[model samples]
Target: MADALVSIQILPRTPNGESVIPYVDRAIEIIQASGVRYVVGPLETTMEGDFSELLEIVKAMNDEMIRLGAPSVLSQVKISYNPTDGASIDRLIAKYRT
Candidate 1:
């Protein structure tokens, strides 16, 4: 079982004041490449995994934004950690799904 659920929204200040969609897309790509279970929502992306690993993913996403030419990055993160019993996205949201 996963030990944490983390939701992150990254805001990158573009180098030339361009659209941030592409940057956001790249961040999601990093999440996908990490092989963690995740959901991309309208405003944020949430992932389920070990608490430390998920936090590392968030750092990687922010670093990628800078590498992609953002002057700086801001990441808003929410975490639900249950080290003993574990946390799961499916278990939390299943009731809302059809």
Candidate 2:
């Protein structure tokens, strides 16, 4: 069994007209800081690690964003379980199924 890969896409609408780059940067920073050996989004961040840990890492990142006063932020998070030794696009395919 392989660890689950979680992908979180943040769509933040800042009333202060804040730049989205910083938001994205902050998100990446938080995610990376979680100690999950995974890649970030918009460029297909391929990560490998524990499933539950990844979930916690992602949730924590979102919580941080909300705590930063972006509670109204819109996010699209996706989780996929890729075999440790197999080619899988199940996540991508699953996206359409929904």
Candidate 3:
């Protein structure tokens, strides 16, 4: 069970004022490599996993953005943690998914 749910929308500032599509693509690539249950919305991407792991992923996303030529990044993050029963991406959306 996932101990937390993390949703993030990263806005990486391009050094050359180029389109950020490629940078955003790299961020999503990091998420894909994490192998977590994730949903990519138009504005944000939500993932379910351990808090530490998710946080690490966030760092990796930021690092990758910098390596990809982003001068800075602004991330909007939301977290839901339930240590007892744990939060689930599927369970939370099952009703709507049906």
Candidate 4:
């Protein structure tokens, strides 16, 4: 099982001040491609995986924004880490799923 859960919301400043949704979409795409278990909430996207790997993913996400016409980025992150038994996204959200 994954040992950590990371939730992130990246706000990239567009070069021309255009809509940020598209850039945000690209960030989500990164998460989608990561192959980790994730849930896209209204405010942020959460991923469950090894702690260090998840931090690397967050860095990639910010870099992606700069590559995609964003001048700068502001990313908010939250992490829950459990190394021994680990944790599953499913287990955490089970009560709210139904």
Candidate 5:
């Protein structure tokens, strides 16, 4: 079981005023590549994993944005952590899915 569920919304400002959708897409790609369980929503993406790994993913996303030409990156993050029983996205929202 995972120790946390992290939801992140990344806002990347391009140097040339380009559309940020591509950058956002790339960030999501990083999440996908991590192989953690995730859910993509309209305003943010949520991932379930170890607390430290999830934080590392956030760092990777910001670093990639800078490498891709973003002068600054703004990230909004929400975390739900349960070190004892652990956290789970499915366990929280399973009732709504039905």
Candidate 6:
């Protein structure tokens, strides 16, 4: 099995009332459009296809957010072949548990 792993963090430039939901939604849209097996953080949303597609989608998602006035967006992505499609992704949870 193969998968594209991504960790996305959105922060407001000024700690004001910024809607992170839109950013999250855009991320989802991008992931879906990419057609690759993915697991969103907090334990849920999985998508599965091409690594290239995932890359493109992620970039687009970030661009969309920037266009929507979120320049303080940060993203970290790691892609690897799972060999056996993971039933769960504890690695991410552990990494971000703090």
Best by lDDT: 5
By lDDT, the candidates rank as: 5, 1, 3, 4, 2, 6
| lDDT winner between candidates 1 and 5 | 5
- Among all windows of 10 consecutive residues in model 6, the one with the lowest summed lDDT is 6-15
- Write down the TM-score for model 2: 0.67
Which candidate, 3 or 6, has the higher TM-score? 3
Residue clash pairs of candidate 3:
none
- Candidate 2 Cα misplacement greater than 4 A, ranges: 41-46, 82-98
Model 2 agreement with the true structure over 1-98: per-residue lDDT tens digits = 44576667776676587876776678788767766566555743444456777667666666767777675677776777655653244543577775
TM-score of 4: 0.93
Q: TM-score, each model?
A: 0.97, 0.67, 0.94, 0.93, 0.97, 0.55
Between 3 and 5, whose TM-score is larger? 5
lDDT of 3 by residue, 1-98 (tens): 89999999999999989998888888999999999988999999999999999999999999999898888999999999998999998889899974
lDDT of 1: 0.95
Cα lDDT for residue 89, model 1? 94
lDDT by residue for model 1 over 1-98, one digit each (tens)? 89999999999999999999999999999999999999999999999999999999999999899889999998999999999999999899899999
lDDT of 2: 0.64
lDDT of each: 0.95, 0.64, 0.93, 0.92, 0.97, 0.57
Deviation in angstroms for 47 in model 1? 0.3
**16-93, model 6: which lDDT tens digit per residue?**
557677667776777666665566656334444444555577678777777877756666555543435632345545
Answer with 1 or 6, whichever has the higher lDDT. 1
Model 4 clash pairs?
none
**Lowest lDDT 10-residue stretch of candidate 4:** 89-98
Winner by TM-score between candidate 6 and candidate 1: 1
1-98, model 4: which lDDT tens digit per residue?
Answer: 68999999999999998999999898999998988878999999999999999999999999999998887899999999999989788888799986
Model 4 residue 19 CA deviation (Å) reads 0.5
Pitting candidate 4 against candidate 6, the one with the higher lDDT is 4
Q: RMSD, each candidate, Å?
A: 0.7, 6.1, 0.9, 1.0, 0.7, 6.0
